[model samples]
Target: MMITSRNTAKAALFLILTFFSAASLWLLLEAEFLAITLILIYVGAVMVLFMFVIKMLDTDQSTLRAQFTRYLPLGIFVSIIVIAQIVLVLNAGQFDIAMTGIPEKHDASYSNITAIAEQLYTLYVYPFELAAILLLIAIIAAITLVHRNESRSKKQNISEQINVQAKDRMRIVSIKPKSAKESK
Candidate 1:
């Protein structure tokens, strides 16, 4: 649905559905933490961001619909091929428990989150830190790209403000007061 949707908002909605489905699969695998994280990160934060971007873009729906119609046949063909491949792989009988053994159950004290953190901070720490730095740079680049310095917009000059004197902004006007309306 997401691939076929012409409307960006609809596509985002479909993506949210996909995220939820993935979270559901995680739950089926008894990975509650992963399921919640997926929902919170992808569905909550990312989907909201996507929706805001879609609204801000205000894309021409007519053009999107036209393009969708143009490439729909190709999309359908690719989708069919993908589905066929998945079916063939599933029917290959290599995924049975006999072939892939049963998963070992951990003790009651075992914590997947702790184990994941250990692995992440141990084996993958450098890559994780690199990814964080890259994300930070990307965020800074995005902010810089969107920061417009328009001449018409007011901007504070700290140096000028600090150097300004009261006299520069204020003037005293002298006016003679009337003597009780000339003693009227």
Candidate 2:
């Protein structure tokens, strides 16, 4: 539905539905933490961002419709290739329980979060740190882009403001008083 929807808002709504379905699947797999994270992060935060961006864009549907036919053939071709690949993989017997033994059940006291943290910190520490650094860089880039056009904006210099003197702000102008007859 997301891919087929002509309206951007409807597409976003479909995407949110897809996210909810994925969260439900995660719940079925007994990964409650992952399910909650998926909903909160993707549906709550990311989808809100997407909706805001889509609204801000105010796209013209006519232009989009005009281009749809141009890409239709390629879209169908790629989709067919993907579906064929999925079918081939499913029939390969790689996912058979006889080939890959059933996973061992953990004890009642076992914490998935703890196990995940252990693997992330120990085995995937470098990649995790790299991802964090990339996110930090992306945040910095976004801030820079937002402030790029604010050259005329007023920005207070805290040090200069703190060091400002009363003398600089006030000018003592002295005017001589003249008699009424002399002024006339």
Give TM per candidate: 0.65, 0.70
How high is the lDDT of residue 28 in model 2? 70
lDDT at 40, model 2: 100
Tens digit of per-residue lDDT, candidate 1, span 49-83? 98988889969867776787889899999999999
Top candidate on lDDT is 2
Cα TM-score of candidate 1: 0.65
lDDT of 2: 0.91
lDDT of each: 0.88, 0.91
Assess the local accuracy of residue 170 in candidate 1 as a C-alpha lDDT between 0 and 100. Answer: 92
Across 1-184, the per-residue lDDT of candidate 2 in tens digits comes to 9988889999999999999999998777666678899999999999999999998997998898899899999999999999999999999999899998966666678776787789999999999999999999999999998899888878899999899999989999898889899899
Model 1, C-alpha of 93: deviation from truth (Å): 5.3
List RMSD in Å for every model shown: 4.6, 4.3
Error of 1 at 116 (Å): 0.5
Stretches of candidate 1 off by over 4 Å are: 1-10, 73-99, 147-174, 177-184
